[model samples]
Target: MAVYVQRQLDRQPERTYVIEGDADGYWKLAQSLIHGEPYSIYTPPRRVLRMPGFPFFLAGAMSVVGEDHFRVRLILALSGAVACFVVYLLGKELVNETIGLIAAALTAVSPVMAGFSVLFLSETLFAVTMLISLWVLVKLSKVQFRVEDQFQGRLWSVLAGISLAVAFYVRPSWLLMLPLVVFILILSAKEHRTAALTRGLLIIVGFTVMLVPWVYRNYQVTGHFVPTTLWAGPSLYDGLNPRATGDSDMTFFDQENVLNSMSEYEMNQHYTKRAVEYARQHPGHVFELMGAKLVRYWKPWPNATQFKSFWVMAAVSVLFIPVVFFAGYGAWVSRDQYLLLLITVGPIVYFSLIHLIFVSSLRYRLPAEYSLYILSAVGFYQMCFSSRQGKELNPE
Candidate 1:
């Protein structure tokens, strides 16, 4: 892990120095956090347009290391290393230690996973938070939900909720996962109705506690209640507009130049209304665009045209195909284990549905990739060892 971090630091300037416009905003936001200055992105009102978690994370790193570009990359690399360990824990809790190690190894070497860590983006931190949340839920699954276990089960549920809240702060779309997870927990503990209800309530409480402050801050800034960041409308429009081409293209709005004059809230409303009208007028086209997005979401290569390096793209495809094949086999073999299946397969399915509605890209698909590692490990173990042992690990 240390070696990986070092290599990333060495290549930081050449490999990861190209900051996208969105990333520039985040970097400036972190700088503002550090220097206590008013920061604006796109235009004035200078509010919390993006999620706050990653900016705060960058701020902490900059505070310690004086905001050097390499230092920021180092922080992300170390975070990636931590994610690898968290993947191990998630795998071990779901299956066995051998699977855990295998998952960790896959995560460490995955081209997308490793590359994301060195880039100035929120995906790495979001992935780590997501894994931590899953780890907590996996632990909670083992609890009996009996009277004796209620207190401990509630604690684990709260921790899961808190971790999920952190992830939500990193990416507002994560908010979609909360209810689905709660629903899974309810179904998993159907026999222990009282305990399940209590656990669910506690989890909601924890999540609400984490989110309320941010909500209040947004209200203060915008003079209206906003649950998450301000980018959702633009993001939605980015995928649904007439010129979407089944991927994110900010030029649709940029060409009009109306967003420049509007406040963030107004801009969001304008784009959202336009996107909805477009979808209404062109339902067949909307479906076609969604189909294209689904394909792009699962494609192994770089989704953007600029990053399409032939050899690198080929290598990613080579690595991704087998892992996905093995992962599918593993998911099939473990189909009977409800809790394990939910943890391993739920995010991929859920996020796929999300992209069907919004936008799709490799970067958008990353949070669920850790779960794929877990499934791939299971597939490898089943192919190599389960047959020899003549038994399967029961996910009770």
Candidate 2:
């Protein structure tokens, strides 16, 4: 928190534009909400381009802080701290306090996590919500799927559902995680399929119920059942278009002047169709693009030019490289713990798969790094201290 505040303080005039790009949109939408104006950006007739979660949260902060970006950064820094503590709780639930503390410490010091924390982007907030959802799912994993234990199990499922819904609002891509989580829950209780199925349904019900209002609002504005935002089309096209380089560059929107000719909804549908058509017509190119995006998704260092400073690269690389190997080791040794592995490893896999189709970057992978830290802590403890303790952690 102190370091984040100090960094924000040191940036001077540019601090208002620190790590901007999407931050500008978020701040603008937030201001709209505060001043009771139309929610639109970039030559708007009130578009539903961005998700409401972060903007709404930011509006609350700006209201209290009177639109001071530094104060907003200070408030966001607290989300970073919450994420670290939640990672600790997740680690403790998965293993022991020692491993939990190690994971939390790693998250607290991670350059990528810290950098995104102070930014006005949704990653840090999403990370906190995602981690909390995973923690609830972990707790759900511990409960026996028996008729008598239905209350406890259902409660956790509902909490997990709510948390996951919150994450989805923050980042629409997370809606894809619902079916995967349901599959995991069902698979975990093979002998008690009825109970597991019931719990899964509860999760879906809880998740869907929470999203009803937002989805309805989207429907009202766009005349379509838009679950999250209309930005998906441009986001998808950003990765699959002919000029794509596996990086997000929406400048083509300006070159093509698509917005001037179409409504936001029409523009979203048009790009989505165009992107899909390009994928179908040029399968080979799509595969190559996917390959490039996969690399960008998993790269240890930032791909953005602004973050190319030698010290920045060194800090990211030094922290990430070791975590990669340690996390791999932890995953290997704990492969038998299917439930634990699902919650710890599932997110990175989910995000990686998503970014392989959408645009990819270190920023997209930040939310999943908390889970990586959990696994890395396991490896760190096993390699450095397990022998000293004279006992191995039982996967069961």
Candidate 3:
């Protein structure tokens, strides 16, 4: 196990540095953000938005070890170590120790997730923090929920919220899980409404407290009241940029395409305006885009695995649906039925919104991936140990 862990840890730095260079926004963004400078508009020059966690960690690493390859690689390897444990804890809640081990094993050697071991990407921090958040929720939801344990739950939930706050800090799109967490509160509060509501409120309160400072910082920088980061408008621009020149997968329904022949930013506004106008003008395309986006997000491509990074991600996303559905359905039939609904609804709604509008990238959805994996493991558990005669086996 030690050798395996070491090997996995050693493999990441070279690949991450190669794919996302050590210079440019990938490395410098961390330095800039940590020094309280302006966030890079295009760092790593691909999809890695200037998230909060990776740069901070890398900066800390730089302080200790200097900006050498050895330092960054070492930090990422340590990051992977924690991520592995988190996967185990998350998997343990859904199934047995064996499955927890399997899940961790999957995370440890996962060609996809293994990158966390080396690269200073948002996915690693997001994955680990998300695991902590979900594990806290699971631990708190037991029938033996005592006052002390409930207090502990409160503490953990607040901590989870902080972890999630860091997740959003790592990648703004992770805000999708916030709604899901809210759904858990709604479902959790059904039976113990007052207490659950109180806990839920406290959780949100904790999350809000953590988030406001960064938002205030963004507001100060951009002269706008932006609650999240500063990439959405530009990202929206990218989607429509190519569309105007017969390059996008989306087709224009009206003069909007013709008008979009302006600057990139101008074309973005045109597409945004037209999407709303066209939705009103042609509700069919809106619905079609919705359906089509869902398909685009899931449907396989030819020789997809060649883009190994995206290929594995698409498979993970597809598998996640089954995991969530089975676990969600099973939980609904149990005593803690509300948790089932909460677990399912918030994340789904959040994911649907992002998957629809934004460009579909694997890393974009990394935050919620842990939740689905946990839920899936639950589904796997229920499948392996079926009720001999309508009997449910609670792992507790």
Candidate 4:
């Protein structure tokens, strides 16, 4: 891992290793926060196009390092280590120590994750926060809802919700996960429906409490209660527009110039309406685009031009293909353990479904890949060493 970081640092002027592309906004936001300037990437008007969690993280690092790219990469590399540790914890909670070690090792060596860790992107941060939240939820599942244990379970549930809120501040794609979690608990806790419902409500309260400040800020700026960001409309149209190809292309934003006569909020609503109308008008074309997105989302290589190399493709395929196969096998063997399946296999499914309506890329899937690694570890351990006499995994 240190060697990979050094290699990336050595490629200073390369766009892949430098602070370019989407990293621009994150770096700009961090500078704004550091210098006590307005939090807008543009001039004068404040905008919520980018989430603040990663920018806040970058701001702290910049305060300490003062624009030193090498030091910033080292800080993010430490975050990558934390992510691997959290993945191990989640794997241990889901299965056993051996599986946890295997999952952590795989995560530590992941080419895609290692590459992203040194860049000024939020995938690594989001992965760490999401894994911690997942680990808390897995622990919560084990706490029986007895009268004396109700308080403990509720507390864990609230912590899980707060962890999820932190992830949301990094990436808004996780917004639907809160409700999905409640639905999963309801389905899994069949006998304790009442208790489960109470926990679910508490989870909502916890999530809302953590996000109130951001929501209030958005409401003050946009005159509406915007729970997420204003970029969703552009993102949605990137996948649903008439020229959509299941990949992101923001050229329309500049070409259309609708913002010339509209507020940011108004532009958002306008693009959203246009995208929905286009999807409705061309259902067949929309379905085809979805199929294209599914292929792109699951392809065993990077989609970005900068990372398109034979060596990179070969390495990613070597890692990604085996993980997918073993994860499927793991899901099959653990089908009876509903909570295990929900925690280990849920995020990829959720993200896959959501990205069918938005832009799709391997970058959008890295945050959930850690969960897939846990499942992959289980399958590898089961197939290689476990007895074949139907001695099933006992996660309890």
TM-scores vs. true structure, each candidate? 0.93, 0.95, 0.69, 0.94
Error of 3 at 82 (Å): 2.1
TM-score ranking, best first? 2, 4, 1, 3
- What lDDT does model 4 reach? 0.86
* lDDT score, candidate 1: 0.82
Model 4 per-residue lDDT at 3: 57
Report lDDT per candidate.
0.82, 0.86, 0.57, 0.86
Runs in model 1 lying further than 4 Å from the true structure: 1-16, 259-261, 389-396
Over 1-396, each residue of candidate 4 has an lDDT whose tens digit, in order, gives 545665665776455444365788888889989999877776335488888999999999999878876678889889998999999999888888878999999999888888788788999999998898888888888899899998899999899789889999998989998998898888878999999999998889889999999999888878988999888888899899888998889999889888778888888899999999999999999999999998889999988786788998999889999999999998888888777788777898889899899989898888899988999998887887676755766664
Model 4, C-alpha of 121: deviation from truth (Å): 0.8
lDDT of 3 by residue, 254-355 (tens): 334443344333443455664455446655544555565565544433122334476655655454456556656545544364453344344545665776
lDDT per residue as tens, model 1, 1-396? 334544654676554344367678789899988998764454545586788899899999999989887667788889999999999999888988888999899888887788778777898898899888888888877888567887889889898789889889998888977888778778767677777878888888889999999999888777878888777778889899877876777776567766568777787788788889889999998999989999999998878876689976986788788889989999899888777778888888888998998989877888788877889999988898889999885532
Q: Pairs clashing in candidate 2?
A: none
Scored by lDDT, model 2 comes in at 0.86
Give candidate 4 misplaced runs (Cα > 4 Å): 1-19, 43-46, 388-393
